[model samples]
Target: MSILRLPARQQVRVLLLSSLVMLAACGEKPQQAGGEMKVPVSVVTVEPTPTEVFVELPGRVEAIKEAEIRARVNGIVQEINFEQGSDVKSGQLLFTIDPAPYIAQRDQAAAQLKNAEADIRSARLFADRYAKLIKANAVSRQEYDNAVAQAGQAEAAVAAAKAALQSANINLGYTRVESPIDGRIGRSMVTEGALVSAASATQMATVQQLDRVYVDIPRSVNQLAQLRRAMAEGVLTRSAEGDALAYVLLEDGAEYEHPGKLLFSGVSVDPGTGQVSLRAEFENPDQILLPGMYVRVRLQQGMDEKALLVPQQAIQRTSDGLNSVYVVREGKVQPVAVSVGPQIKGSFLVYKGLNPGDVVVVEGFQKIRPGAAVQPIPWKQAGAKPGSQPGGPAGAQPEPEATPKG
Candidate 1:
C-alpha cells in the first residue's frame, strides 16, 4: 500500500491528508512530568508567640502650669520689662503702671496720718491735765468728761488714718506688676501707655511652664468598661507598670524622643462625651511639645502570654466587610474566616478562626481558587536585606485579593 504506486488523483488526496496530520502533530501541547501545575505561593505557618499589646488613642498636649498675667490695679501701663515670648522668673517685674497718682495718694495718706497723730497728742495732753485737775478739784467734772471724750475721738481718727495709709501703700505696690510663676511668657496683651483696670482684670500676658507638659487623653466610657471586663475575665492582664509608661506620636507621624508617665485617671466621666479623662506627663526640655497640640498616645494595656499573630497583608476583607485568609491545608487552597484583634508591628492578633500549624498564604493567592493545589514557599518581605530570613513563620504570600500595605 505505497501511496507512490497509486493513481495520480489518489496520490494527490494522500498528500493532502499527510500534510493535515503533520499540522495536528505540531499543534499538540506537550505533556508535563506532573499531572497538574501547582500555583506557587508564599505562606507562613501560624505559631503562638509571646507579645506585648498596646492601645492607641488621640490625645491633647497641655502645659502643666498656666498663668494669666492680668492687671491688679487700675492705671496706665508705664513700661513693659520682659521681651515678648521670652522665659521669665518668678517675681520678675513684667510691667509698671503709672505710679504718679498712687504716689500722691500715698503721700496724702501719710500727711493725714501725721495730722491725726498731732491731733491725738494734743487731745491726750488736755485729757491728762483734765484728769489731774479733776482729782485736785481744779476743774468741773463735766469739763473733764468732755476732754476725755475728745481724746477718744482723736485716737479713733488716728486708727482710721493708719488704715488709710496701709491701703495706699498696698495700692502703690500694685503699680509694679510681677510674674507669679517661673515660665515662658507669651505676647504682651497690653502695650505701653495703655490703660488697664482692676475691675475688668485686663490680661497683660500669659505664662506657661513648658519644661514638662501633660497629655490629656480621653477614652469613651464604653471602652473603659470593655477593658475592665477583659481584665476581669483574665483575657487581658494589665501591665505591671499600669498607666505609668506612655509614648507619644506627633501630629506629623514622628515619634517623640522622650517617654511619659501617666498622672491619674479621672474619677468622673464627662457628661457630654461620656468619656473618662486620663493625664500623662512628659519631659519637654526641648520645648517641642506645645499646649493644644494634637498627638497620639500609645499605652501598654496588657499582655497575652500565648497569642497568634498574622501578617496584616494576609488578612483579607470581603465586600460585606468580613475578614478571611487563604489557608493551605493538605496541599489545597481554603478560604478560612478569621477574627482579628489589635495590630502590632504590622501584624494582627488572631483571636479566632486560625490555629497553630495552619499554613496561611501571604502572597500569590490571586492565581488560585478554593480546592486548587498550590506550591507553598517561604514568603519574604519585599525590601528585606539580602540573605535575611523570610517574613512571618516560614513566609506566606497572597494573590487577586489585594495585599494590604503595612
Candidate 2:
C-alpha cells in the first residue's frame, strides 16, 4: 500500500478519480443554494368594510352674538352699576348719569303749570262777571268777548307747561343705562365723572354671548366639487339628514369633548382664495373656546360601505406617478397597480385593482423581488419573529437535501 511501491499508471488513475469526485460535490452545492433559498416576508389579508372619510380644515372661533353698549342721554357719568368684565343680564343697570339737571327742569315746569292754572281760574271768574253784566245791559258786548278770549289764552299756557314736564321726565329716566342683552361684558369704556352726550354717543362697554359659539371654516371650492361628483357617481354616500358631524382638534392635538353640527355652507366663493365658507355651531357652556382662536375641524364628509383599506406603509408610488403594492399569491411575490382614494386612519382606501382575501406584503419588502418564491408570515411590529412551541415547525422548512448521484 506504500506510494513508492505502486506502479506509475495506477497512481495516475487514482488521482484522476479523486479530482472528478471533488468537482461533482462543488457543482451540487450551488444547485441547492439557487433552488431552495426562500425570502421571508410579512403579509396582511385584504378585507372590505365600512369606512368613514373625514376632511380636516383650519377655522376660527366666533361669538354667537355681540353688542356694544352706548350712552343715550346727555349728562355726566356719576356711577358704574356693574363690575367690569362680568356676566350681565338684559335690562340690568350698567351705568348712572347725573339726574340733578333733569330733576330741576321738571320741578320748574311743574311750578309754571301751577301759575297757569291760577291765571285760568281768575280769567274764568272775570268772564262770568262780564257775561252777567252784558245780560243786564250794563256791560258792552265787546267786553264779554275780551274776557272769553283771556280764559282761552290761560288754558293754552297750561297745556304748554304740561308738555315741558313730560319731556323732562323722559330725560330723567334716560340717565340710567341698562344692558341690551344677556352676555359677558367687557371693560368700561367711559368711567365715572366723564361727560357723555346723545349728539355723539360714547361706547360704554361691549357684551358678547359665549354660551354657544360659531366656528367659521373655509374649504376649497374645487375640492368640494370633487366630493359632490364622487357622491353622484355612487362612490360615496352622504348622511341621510344632510348635515355632517364635526369635531375640533386643538393646537396641542387634543380633541374637543363636545361635538358640533354643520349649520350651512356658503354659496358664493371667495374670489381671491377660491374657497367657500362653512359655519358650525358648538355648545360652549364652559367658555373654553374663545373668539379668534385657531383650530382644526374634522368634518365627516361621507361613508363607503365596501371600502378596501391597506396600511400606508405597503403602498409605493413609482417615479412615473403609478401607485402599486407588493402582493403574495400562491407563495410568490408580485407587484400590482392600485388606485388609491383618500386616506382614513393611517390607511389608504383602495378604490380598484385589489380583491378581498388577497395577501399584501406589509413588511420585509426589501428582501423580496417580483416572481420570487417567498415564505409569507403574519406581520408583527418590528422584525421580531413569531415564537414557536418547542418541537414545532417555525415556518416553511428548507427543501430536502438533494441525494448525491453515484
**Residue 304 accuracy (lDDT) in model 1:** 60
Put down candidate 1 lDDT per residue, 1-406, tens digits, no spaces: 8888999999999999999999999999997687778999988877777655666788899999999989888999999999999999999999999999999999999999999999999999999999999999999999999999999999999999999999999999999999989999999999998999999999999999999999999987776776676667766666666565778877776778998998888999889999999999999999999999988887666666566787789999878888999999889999998777666666777777887888999999689999999999977766766544222321111111221111
Per-model TM values vs. the true structure: 0.81, 0.68
Instruction: Judging by TM-score against the true structure, name the best candidate.
Output: 1
lDDT comparing candidate 1 with the true structure = 0.83
- Candidate 1 residue 173 Cα shift, in angstroms, is 1.8
Residue pairs that clash (backbone atoms under 3 angstroms), model 2: none
All candidates' lDDT scores? 0.83, 0.80
Task: Write one digit per residue (lDDT tens) for candidate 2, span 97-166.
Answer: 9999989988998899899999999999999999899999888899899999999999999899889888
Q: lDDT (0-100) at residue 282 of candidate 1?
A: 98
Error of 1 at 394 (Å): 23
Best of the candidates, lDDT: 1
